[model samples]
Target: MTTIPEIARAAGVSTATVDRVLNRRTPVRESTSRRVLDAAFSLGYVTSSDVERLSESEPLTLAFLLPRGTNPYLALVNHRAHAFVERNRRDARVKSYFIDGFDPDELARSIRHFARRADGVIFMAIDHPKVRAATDEIVASGKQAITFISDISTSRRHAYVGIDNFAAGRTAALILGRFNGGREGRVALIAASRIYRAHMEREVGFLGLVEERFPGLSVSATREGHDDRDENYQHTRRLLDKHPDIIGLYNVGGSSDGIGRALRESGRAQDITFVGHGLTRDTRAMLADGTMDAVITQDPDALFEAAVLAATKGTPPVVTAELYLSENMPPE
Candidate 1:
């Protein structure tokens, strides 16, 4: 393995400069940083990531990016995340920046702004190329990148803190298959967008598992609801109108209320069994009302802790997930 000293010598910089660039302690001129990075890359000199303690010396800041979720289920995540940050603030060892929603250009601007301000960033945005590129620039600017919920495409983010989406998809298929008593029927999948890696992988995993395990169940159609209630309503209505045989629906994103409404309006509520994602207030109510069968869930508190740990400590996270049903929930 090529040593930092060797790279420093080759790049015509001191070993201290190489160390500073690697640890992101101080900003070097862009040309010097590039030369050192290129030399390290060429020599395959990967930096060690042993967690260095905070030293009780310098304070830190972490930036967070997440889509604005008005739905009670997801709102809980945001609220709890903010509280968690506050708890960490008493020592003045941590600070936070929250980006409300996702707009490619706005998020990009936010990333650029935070790159200079934060020691680390925890991103929950979609996996768009532009988002990834902006995150990469943040990394290049020396901030540790921690991605939560969805993995971005172009950035070499430091850690991922959420459920293994493929496994979640497989779990969904298993639950749905058992719900149907192994009797296959047409299934409809509605997602927020293809830009979210977790959502896309869940759909892929669901289809893969169903095809491999329960070959009789067929997918009727897939639609992008963009995680909007009105859009979900319209898409659900269209899908039901076009495919009256659809026996199951999986909502892998926000706001299943619209879909529930569409099914009720179509007089097909009893005809279809719905399995959705998350444990939002509305979804929990739907499960209670028997509008939805079950929900695949990740604990919001655990997710927030894991995200913060990964942001500050730069370690891989293990997600603890659960399958929720009406019988399993606490009485309201």
Candidate 2:
């Protein structure tokens, strides 16, 4: 097998430089690092066991800052992270913290607290200046900062590991429109908040598609659910009362349970074509009962693995959005 010394010689760098680039213990010039990696790959110098041994010597400590809520998707993400750490025990350790609310100052403090402790940090970011500044500072301090599920565009996050949310929105719109089948009534949009970039982007895509393709279907003004079941229930109830001809509903964020409850209470469960995000237990039941028409989802397991890989390997995995329906729901 080829060796690091041979790769260093071929790349015209010293063995120490090659080691530093491979281990990522210290910063190296981007050009030099690329050259060394290219040489190593060309010579097939590093084996999987060699990489595993290196990881065992310097195990990664990754901290995940997730939202504190009953949102099934976030719970799934937390579960997947722990599972990954257990499966790769020698390579990494994951510690997850749940931020209680949408206070950017509190979130910033949490980020700073983990800055010096973990090798990398991942979070579902709110698109606020304070949070963005904190993320950029973490990246500048030589720790990887990754955004998962949602992104803060202004920050210097190493990478984002989730589906293309705008595309997911467009896909949802396509499904909703088809399911409604030439209906000429209002479609309501519900979201967690405009502060979440992912939800905002999804809302934009959904609105654009509706305006372009479903002109006959008017859209109600967006209502913020804050991913709260009660809040979403109120929003749905209000929309139903105001728009008696509502034909479709698209929930761009969480709280499918509240939406389903409102629909059932109003005796509109079968009348409205509902499309929501996340394939949680609530959504699965709703799908089976004909309350939710389809669910737009991304694999939480894939997201956790991508975040880990990005933190340790400097390459992020791409996860695509999945469409789940009653017939195709994956078994728990």
Candidate 3:
């Protein structure tokens, strides 16, 4: 971490002066404060408060491009991000737009639109040539572009503010494999879509770990639901019908409610081990009712905060995944 003394030294100012600027305990000249802020920002140590004091003119305009959906987790992210902006009205001007996550042409166009309107752009990216080209073009135009939730490959996005999906996949596998009592037959994997880099990575990690550690558990079927409840329900029912050997089910994306309903109606909810991502109300209820065995999740508020930091300060915080079970579910 960059310390105050380091920022003060880089700015050729006293530590007391830096403190005064950061805390607003006393008035410091705008030029001196800008110098300190520049030093702190260069060192990847600028905080929201530091950016708060960096400018007295127009605030920095940032845009968040999210997916339009009823997925509770994404909705929570959108809510928290807007709430963050409301709280930091003096430091940032945040505009959030919901776009289709699977439409590359629309996503790419939205990126360019935000690039023209905002100082920074943060979005859930679909990994496609069109999106990658747009990312490059936006960055070349001298604006910050950060990828949220899902990222694009070969893009110029400054930072990604989400947990490691591959590791989350491996964690899901590890939990499900152990929960099967060493008598695994097959595992089914479901994702939102493989077009998002995060889903693809998670699928790879889950399959790799299941094969590496649990030899008996073969991944027999993979399906895409696009995080839609009805689609996930239909897919899950079909999977259960076709794959009687499935001893474990791993949801690499959202819409766990549909999966739960399918398993419960199939009268085999307790026979198979189920693991999924996110800690939304649906998952929480499923976990309590024994439909879900475990939830591998990251905090939504923490993720939004990291996204803001990455967008404004160029320093993204690491958001670690948390495991939730019925017995150890967090207090709301």
Highest TM-score: give the candidate number.
2
Put down candidate 2 lDDT per residue, 1-332, tens digits, no spaces: 78888999999999999989788776576678778777887788766565444333357788899888767778877887798778865656889999854778888888888878998888888889999899989899888898888988867889988999999888888888888888789899999888889999999999899888888889889999888889999999999998999999999999789999999999989989999999888999999999999999988778888888888788987898989999999987
Clashes of each: 1, 0, 0
Candidate number that wins on TM-score, 2 or 3 = 2
Q: Which residue runs does candidate 1 get wrong by more than 4 Å? A: 1-59, 69-71, 88-103, 330-332
Model 3 CA deviation exceeding 4 Å by range:
1-57
Judging by lDDT, tell me the better candidate of 1 and 2: 2
- TM-score of model 2 vs. true structure: 0.84
Local lDDT at 37 for model 2: 76
RMSD of 2: 5.5
- lDDT at 184 for candidate 2? 89
Q: Give lDDT tens digits, candidate 1, residues 1-332.
A: 78988999988999999997777786466578777777776777753222123112244577766666444556667777777767754322344454545567777787778767777777776677777888788787778788878776656788888888888888888888878887757888999877778899999999998899888899965798877788899999998888867888888877888888888889887668788888888888888888888888888778878877775556766986688888897543
lDDT of 3 by residue, 1-332 (tens): 78999999999999999888777665466789889888888898876675874555455688889888757778877777788778765656888898898899999999999899888888998999999999999899878888988878877789988899999888899999999979959888889999999999988998889889989878866899998888889999999998898889998998788999999999999999999988988999999999999998888778888877886678999988899999999976
**Model 1: number of backbone collisions:** 1
| Model 3 clashes, total count | 0
